[model samples]
Target: MAALYTTRSLSAYADLLDHAGILAARPEAAAEATTTISFATDDSREVQPGTLFVCKGAAFKREYLVNALAAGAVAYVSEVDYEIDEELGRHVPCLIVSDIRATLALIADALYDHPSGRVSVCAFTGTKGKTTSVYYLRSMLAEHAKEHGLPAPAFLTGVEYDDGVEQGESLLTTPESFVLERRIAHAAEAGCAHLVMEASSQAMKFKRTLGVEFAVGAFTNFGEDHISPIEHPTLEDYFESKLLLFENCHTAVVNLDTDVAERVLAVAQRAPLVERVLTYSLEREDADVTVQEFERTDGGIRALVRTPRFTRWLLVPSPAAFNLSNALGAITCAEALGMSANAIEFGLASARVPGRMELYPTESGRVLGVVDYAHNGMSLEALLNDLRAAYPDRELAVVFGATGGKGVDRRETMGEAAGKLADRIVITEDDPGPEDPAVICDAIAAAVSAQGHQAWQIVLDRSEAIETAVRETAGQAVIVVTGKGNDPFMLRHGVREPYEPDGDQLKRALAEWDAAN
Candidate 1:
């Protein structure tokens, strides 16, 4: 394999860190400063000759560093020095810093020759609709690029990552600093003009995206989610973490329809790096982009969208009303990039996010099946309410489960939402980790029962749960299966066990229903 970065002397990194005020101490000797580093990584397994290994995360171990040294790592950077015995491991130079996370972002950016500077990077951060908005923008940008004979845009979302050269399933919403910088570099080298990505709160709080300069940054909306000990301890911390995106962006896009719009706008206006602030809305007429009116169609929803440059009717191919807001956010981003109206319209009509509001066909026309990734309370409520409006006469049944070991509050919130909106609820396993599936289901069931709604059942196996929801509610109903979406693996204990995707399982269940009937 070829090197992803150009070789740089050890002193160059030390100088960079010192200027950032995070450098605690430099290399021990002048001769060690001249050592050349050709690669940088946090994963010790990827260490190569002349690699600058980074020690990060709470789970990091001294044995990983020792292995890196054995694999010919020239140097390492960490917040603390692990005194390695000379007899067990070779002695190598190291750099100590006050903040290892920030140091990793800075060093990775330098090693990749600052790829964000070469590509027009746009990032979206919020509690909901981030992945959908990212797909919307990518579609518009890609269509514009294709029309003008330019390369396709690269994107990073919860569903997938496309770096212009390679495309695959994404393991993280926002990748680590080293992997992110390398992918940005690859996109730049592959001639991709734009890179669209999601800026997750955890990623922002940890400084994973510290050194990347965004051409445009957008805030879709904010809500109470990701609250737990292992994640954000409070709602305020989550919101503030998302606001960090504006600190390095040239233009800020705000959604005026959000409840916290004023606070978001105030923070964006106060950001030193933000040169411009643009607002979009589904309610207010004064926003830069606004949805004047909308109505449902058999194919999807069509809206009369008004922008600074154009006022046209746009069609979004989805029955959910909230999707119109997501589309309007995408329109704001496309306009910020100076895209043509034709491109925006075409892209909005053609864009489809995998496992997001995906409607499945049933052999019996009496039943409608929808698959989505709405795991949290806010998102699930929005999806269920929208479905109620779309299919008023049909019964609504939801199949879902909360993840284990994190976001412990979601069980109650999701249960409450489902209890209040859905006619029937089926609780099932969703990445139970080390916890018992029955225990997690019982917690959710208790919340559902608290709502005075007892029409809920627990099914441990996900595939059987989905089939039960379909087979039982066989007529005049909308069967909504959510939580896992297009994810192909179930995390049990600490292992990723292969499992059928939710959409695929739903389809198979529908087929079986048809055959039996």
Candidate 2:
């Protein structure tokens, strides 16, 4: 007898559905005929022959179906039936379901051979530390695997995606279910033991992470973010969406350091699928993972981790206390993953996240330039506080700008924080999309002046503002530039205009400041 193999056919896909309407030119195509789909995609251009194209999203149009069919899509999965032109009606087929988002996830899982079950999926979700915690887990897990002669862990984060073999730009925090499952399948085929990812609130709210089970789900602090007409309409919705990740994970590693910790834990405990909830804290003593002692060093911040199992020292190369909490969350997740303490300690010592608190020192040692991704009010306040704590003797000079068309209240909050905390302020452009940069700066400056800030400048050009901040601030001053972290361009009038990075501009500004002095 020949070897038997299992493959999902059109009939099997129909079996997974409780109710659906099938529209096809050929009735047999919609019936159980044993035809296997080779690929699936939501993008019309990505469709190929024998593809199951998913027509989704509230903004979807009929043109997408025509394009998908033109690109050789054999079938479509959508919430509603798409009308076809009389000439092409006979050749196109669509499977209409009530819930396209959930249907897409279930179908993608079946198509990808259920890869999430093959690897340890560890996810991090929160308002602030999701990106940083994702990076931390990848570094720690990779080091642990390398030391033990195992394959590196894979990650899908806001900054980038590491497939355990190579890194690539990440277009979204969490990709669509089809793309995400396919990437996980790639990792499983590459012999990866773990897949670490950031579960964005938007992804959770929209069911983009549906059908994927996580072994470990970590929460690293939460705040009010992504709240707008196009994003989450309110804070409660945002928080509830983040809690969705716990429902798909076996273990929950939560940070007990942020606001509303009790409420967050209460919600996570209600997740039916979560078996264990582990807590980590930088200040609270009762957490499962707690920091016993810490101090700022020339290289970074050194700390001691105390847990029920062991006490280990961690030398995290970032001075922010919030990042320490992020590291602790990663460490707790690593412990859940059975990584050794040595590997965790070593990884934390060497890991560095680009654009997150990137620091540059001047030759005179009196002026320090810092580039960070502190866009919102809460993050900005935390960053400025950390900088103030780090350099008690140095005056704090800040350059920042609010994003346009969204986060409308951030300008006032950020300006208030800077006015109270900063000695000198420079308001500049940060992705002022479709809004005048000077107008945004004026809002921030008005708030600063209201708070009695004496010295301020509004420079529309980001580079010029940075140079002015660097040149005007003299000895023992910390010149901090917030927002625009690692972004290659600025958004204006719905277009991404090419611009130099904050680090490059800072280097040039510092060089000029040096040359003039």
Candidate 3:
């Protein structure tokens, strides 16, 4: 069946669909006679049959029309006031909408059976930890409440999956808006009590997160990166764009650790619907929920969680104090939803976000290794500090650098961080998307040199960098691998290919080293 939209219903938003224009047909007949009472879309894959197909914008590819039509699209919506070729539209019906993108939204709103009113949704935005914090929130909610014994952690993510489950490879940080809502509706049908999602800076800036209200919103943290002509042009605009999430939500969950947290909180205050403000932090004593006693461990930090109702030792899995902030954000969210101490402890123990602060053990005496997604300076410094505290007497070997095609600002930032934090910094290629690996390492070296670091080397081969870092340390050392946590591919020239830079590979290498002993 085609995606259905009644002419009577669409007539109400005719001007909305066409950017101040009304729907019209070729015959110039009465709106009733010419208007598509209903037709299936042929060009857009997102548009179902009997739904309106947008035929505006020259950049619109022919493949979109062909695939959508083949899938049983029937009606067409266009701004060109022209017809698709006969082969493309022999059976497809057509009409003219004033604007194509707006029409797409209008039609999609009707097709999901109008699901917005039925769900309790939320959106999370930041440069890092969006996915991890969201997964933690969803999993916590799923375990606490048994709403009909069917309320499970349900939602879409920016990751890839092998079992069609939530945990898998991440192809994108945020998908298209059309697909995002559809996936949320599925979770709603599954009786999800909450929709926790990572709202990227790009998503909000492009208006991709519009047409929804987040019951809860958040800002994780920020740094000087993602500033580009294609991305955010400046740090202020980048921060301001992400601040929109706080406004769109009813209750805001904030991280006082964020440098821009105060400004973000101001945005939340402006929302007429915002009812409450919840906060979390590792350093701030005044936070609603805070870590009273923070102690670093071989794997991660063990923070004594303190809220008005409960105080318990919370153990984080990943080995970074940056994770301290991430875990604090999640705990604040869990508590605002009225989660118990038992539930909070349980969820914290069960919480394991892919590639955030993942750690693995090795056979060598005093050998600890961590793999993390800390591709920037703020995060790298935090992880290094935690490692230094955990093994104050030991050396810290660092491996990390910039991703290809990403801003070089991250390159300089990470370099500065490692120079200040690590005893031995071996700069390695991280994804190098389309840019040369040597180029990224040079940027890192320049930054490290400016800091007057003594022991820093540039290794374009990522695996070699990890291996060399591992080999350089003898008695006791912590090796930290930044920029690709649990990532299976190395993106070169915009295409992701198979590459594994595993910190746990040290486990096998350690065995070989121990054999010689």
Each candidate's lDDT (Cα)? 0.91, 0.83, 0.68
- Cα lDDT tens digits for candidate 3, 1-517: 2222234433434544444344554322344243443543323645544455566455877667666666655445666544555776364445565545545544545445444445666667777777778767766666675433646655545654221123445566655545555555565565666666778877776655655567777778877778877688899988888887765577788888867878777877887778998888877889898988877665456889898788889887665666677777878877776777777776676776777666665654666777777777766777788778767988888888888776668878888888888889898788887788898899889999888898999888877787787777776777778788777788888788887646556555555555554
Error of 3 at 513 (Å): 3.1
Could you give candidate 1's per-residue lDDT for residues 239-309 as a string of tens digits? Answer: 99999999999999999999899999999999998988999999899999998898998779999999999
Q: Candidate 3: how large is its RMSD?
A: 4.0
Q: Model 2, residue 241: displacement in angstroms?
A: 0.8
| Top-down TM-score ranking | 1, 2, 3
The digit string of per-residue lDDT tens for model 2 on 199-291 reads 999888888887799999988878777788978999999888998888888998888887878887887788888888899998799999999
Point out the higher-scoring one by TM-score: 1 or 3: 1
Per-prediction CA RMSD (Å): 1.6, 3.3, 4.0
Candidate 1 error regions (>4 Å): 1-3, 83-91, 515-517
lDDT of 2 at 367: 78
Best by lDDT: 1
- Winner on lDDT between 2 and 3 is 2
What lDDT would candidate 1 get against the real structure? 0.91
Residue 306 displacement (Å), model 2: 0.7
